[model samples]
Target: MPSLINDQLPPVRHYEAAPLTKEQLDYVDLPTIDISSFTASADPNVRSQLVAQVRSAIAKYGFFYVLNHGLSTAQTVRMFDIADVPFSDVDDDEKKKYQSRLKETGTQQGYKPRQYHHIDNGIRDQIEIYSLNHDVNKSGHPAALRPLLPEIEQFAYHNHVNVLYPILRLVELHKWEDMSESSGHTDIGSLTLLYSQPIAALQIRTKDGSWKWVKHIENAIVVNAGDAIEFLSGGLYSATIHRVVQPPADQRAYTRLGLFYFVLATEDVKLKPLNSPILQRRADIWLKERFQGAEVPTMAEWRKGRTKSDGNAELKASATNLGVEEEYLNGVLIKHYV
Candidate 1:
């Protein structure tokens, strides 16, 4: 038996196991779209067909990989590698400045980063992030983005405006999650851009009702949906069930320096199917469509356990006011079925 004397026993601690190796990473070859197809197609019909397909995927899978987009190959690689630089290598004061300011001003949401729980069950996903909001009125002018990360700031701007906006018509990038793998809850947004290094830990809710791995592709951008799309389609779409499971015990993983850009439908806009009128007109099929198979939990269901934490009380970010509130209509969300 171990004695109470401090000297009798050595200090020990528990550390997370290693991350999944390349062979072990989930290799997901999801559908990819060639952006040029929409732009270069002289044939109007082909462009329509492609856009229709991409839109359908967003509505249904809530996740997809895009290719042949405007981003350059060299730029992509650099984006992945830049975050790997040692902030300690920089003027120590630079990192200290970041830490001090973040601690003082709260998070990009005007709240402290320490107050909230990633999940209700005492999980600590300690990440600190800032936001870059672009003012739409200023055409040439960009948003106040990436002041600390100036290296990627230009890339973010050009992508958001030139490439992404024309295609997705997204207005502004919401507060980026200053986090790494460790999924606790989901949220309601139109779209998300999962920008990460070669971190092989993108896990998602599999179609089989099990959470499986999403193979991480270095320098590739992945997009997914949120509750807003689900609500608008009346659940015809998927908000996706994704999380960052730390690399398993043996494969210690690299620290994931990733950004999740929650894309919103320009505020005040309503999301509906192009065929919304047609779908709404057919109530029975709509009902059938919404309740296709095994039901997943709602935002409220997944969020049942979340509450505030104490370590960072100064940055208490409250949940959005019951955002994306709606009923699935004969869906599994209801209880006491008559």
Candidate 2:
């Protein structure tokens, strides 16, 4: 119910890193379903059946799309239209302006889009963002900022602030690192996303443990489980793996727009097993999959408890043992399970 704002810049939750490769891209698919079916179901039994289907898709694939999700086509198009702007590319003067924030924040974590991604194609991604999470000092002001590093968002960010603000409240998190890399990861949370339909290149993992491509379906929105869902549901659901791959050597970084709406925990929510009998054994297996001494939090519990510091440094040391890239959210956990 509190607010979060940084002085120099807003709090950033999503991270942008280098894009994934094509060969690596061949591993997953986002699932699709019709949300309208909920309206059509004639009986409670049928509705339960649908919920079960949702649960199964989550456990098996960790990603899926919902048709008739209730978002309007106009809103969907406008969001992407706004996304067509080229914000990721850094000009010479812009880069220097951002450098000042790095000194003021006294943190390596600053506005760093250009430094994070050097490639700039013809039309760069117009989508720019600002973020704030868990800075108790800035909790009420909604403007208390850590210093801006490389780039600061335009004042127009507030135009959509009314619409976007409610979405962040849905988060239950663990430590949220800046997602700037070729490929990174996400904490297990309920992702209620509103995506642009005229776009492409969204892929997710599949039920058979394979990868499949999911193109944007008109008027439909995709929902996927994050690690928290998998942990809390005791393996009845899974935290899906997904990524945005670079178009080609000939391509630029500005792709279409994607707004990820996340719901996470406020404190360190434990993940053991659900009380459901069918899930107990799977939960045990999942627990075994977790590395020892890991800080596992449900989306809701972790977000409220996080303060940006060196806590993740302890995690960095552990991640080396798993043989995966260092930056993805659950790099160690994914490698351990997969």
Candidate 3:
């Protein structure tokens, strides 16, 4: 067991793991769009086609695959390799040195151990996570990761500038569970890009409220819209609800590694519907009620408060009000549903 007053463990030199075997399993087949088409040429027709496809995918699925995202497969594979350094290569003692101080910082930039998150039926979460912010220099990272900062920073920049920006331009846009390794919930950012190995644990909730596995595609980025996009689009775009459980029987024992980039709005941006006619037309009463006479939280406050409240037993117990799971931050009532 990882404990306080522990002596420092040996520095992590590197991590190596056998590749997981792939299996054909039932999964939610999400729409896919090649973002390179939108960025490679200024031809209006190509741009329009890409935009239309993205718009349709967002409206119907709220999630999709992004192809030819400019990063080579080797680069992405190396990231999962680097991720292993912190999560697997190091001892629990080493990870303890960098555990996240969520109560104080309200950020996910450090290590989060398995069972750190609360789940129902007295079951804590079954997976661990280590997150990094855009500013790589801000934290005292693991030793094995320090020498590779340049590569990591470049990768993060590519996901944001080359990959995320083009997709962002498509509509200017828009953008579980646990049973459970992760609990069911929607992401709180504008957009999210996930890259993972072929594992069958990740699932998305459908319109009928059934869970469907998200199949892994080699070298393709899984893209999903978050609450920020839904708010900005006035509910035109959906915020996907998804979660992760243990992998299926064939791949039950393999380690599942996922690489993700969460794109958040700037701290100063207000969380309100945009000033577009299309958005205005789609704005329903419930959406209006959320903001009417309510002090909307800026991205900073919303992110901070939500992060701090995520694992709070008291907050989770008190989350229900009139049968709705909610928390108040900066006078704004943020609601939650699986």
Candidate 4:
């Protein structure tokens, strides 16, 4: 895998980013499930054990860590190496040429410059993102990234097909409050897989309505259920609200590089709860009413609206919820905490 990367690019290690202090390492206690057996073994007992762990984790926490899902340390480090190239090497003009067309095309498929998202109190976000949709050839990307597409494609496929699919299939299967740098909100997609970064900024809201840091595990992927799954499960699976904040003083100087894969349902699929009795029996009345009408947006309309609306979030009072404001996506009200 190292040979696949350009020799000219220096290696970037996750631990080098920022080491957390003893006190800074306070992380929420969450289950860590080893999934190697489930992905490799055909044995039903092996698979069932894995499923049981996942079912319990999701039911209790809405988030958990997955170990041995097939990615390696060197391979993971190489990704950060690739990530550093766009922001550190490419010029602003060249990068902007491929700037995210989320505003127009409704697809977040290109470079998103720093401070692109608005936060509260006149603060703009400090993160830069270069998102590649499932289709790599759909549009042009930065020239520097061209040489690395093969590597990127392989990595993306590993996540989408190799890892996400099996997890999605089990049992058909079972399926945070924070206001910080990235603010408190739920992900619009079905599932989220975030690779580990040593920075201590990511936090998850607990069942008690308090936030706690998420500890970094070596070579482990942070898996969390999102809004789509919650909807599909009839709200049986909670879409945990989490956010990013500035790292401790020791880590603030280093740039934080995150690798994430968001799983979204297909465009034409109607946004309705599945007919599974296990899902339908949940007591989430709001989830039922939210999609009860024929006017519910298709995945396409909902995704496009959510992606575009997020970038242009206009802060205003919400008549419904306090301590937050409102935005809309295809007539659906999306709230952002202050």
In candidate 2, stretches whose alpha carbon ends up further than 4 angstroms from where it belongs are 1-30, 39-42, 81-128, 132-188, 192-196, 205-211, 248-254, 266-268, 282-285, 291-323, 326-338
- Residues 1-338, candidate 1, lDDT per residue (tens digit)? 11112343222221222244645554555666666676677787886777676777675556777666555655554444443332213343343343323333322321123333333246566554433333322112111222224444455555455445434632332222211111422444556777534546676665654556666554556877775556455656667867666665444434555654555444333334325565566534544554554344342222221112113322323344221222232242321100
What is the C-alpha local distance difference test score of candidate 1? 0.45
Q: How well is each residue in 162-193 modelled by candidate 4, as lDDT tens digits? A: 67766675223221011000177888777789
Please tell me which predicted candidate would have the highest lDDT against the true structure.
4
Report each candidate's C-alpha RMSD, comma-separated, in the order given: 13.9, 10.2, 7.9, 5.3
Q: Which scores higher on lDDT, 3 or 4?
A: 4
**Per-residue alpha-carbon lDDT of model 2 for 1-338, expressed as tens digits?**
11123354323433232343333334244556665555566787766666676666666666666665444655444334333222333344553443323222323222333333211233333223423222312212111132332122221132123222222222233223311110334443444354524334655545444445655567565666665566666656556666554444422453445554444433345555556778775766677666344556543333322212112322232344442333223322332121
TM-score of 3: 0.84
Identify the runs in model 1 with alpha carbons over 4 angstroms from their true place.
Answer: 1-20, 81-120, 135-153, 162-184, 248-253, 270-275, 282-338
Ordering by lDDT: 4, 3, 1, 2
Off by more than 4 A, model 4: 1-16, 170-182, 282-288, 292-294, 316-322
TM-score of 2: 0.55
Global fold similarity of model 4 (TM-score)? 0.87
Q: Write the per-residue lDDT of candidate 3 for residues 139-234, one digit (tens) a residue.
A: 888776776666666777777777877777523332200000016677888888898567678888788777788877889999998877877767
For TM-score, the strongest prediction is 4
What are the clashing pairs of model 3?
176-183, 176-184, 176-242, 176-243, 177-183, 177-184
* Candidate 2 least-lDDT 10 residues: 174-183
lDDT of each: 0.45, 0.42, 0.71, 0.72
After aligning candidate 2 to the native by TM-score, how far in Å is the CA of 37 from where it should be? 3.1
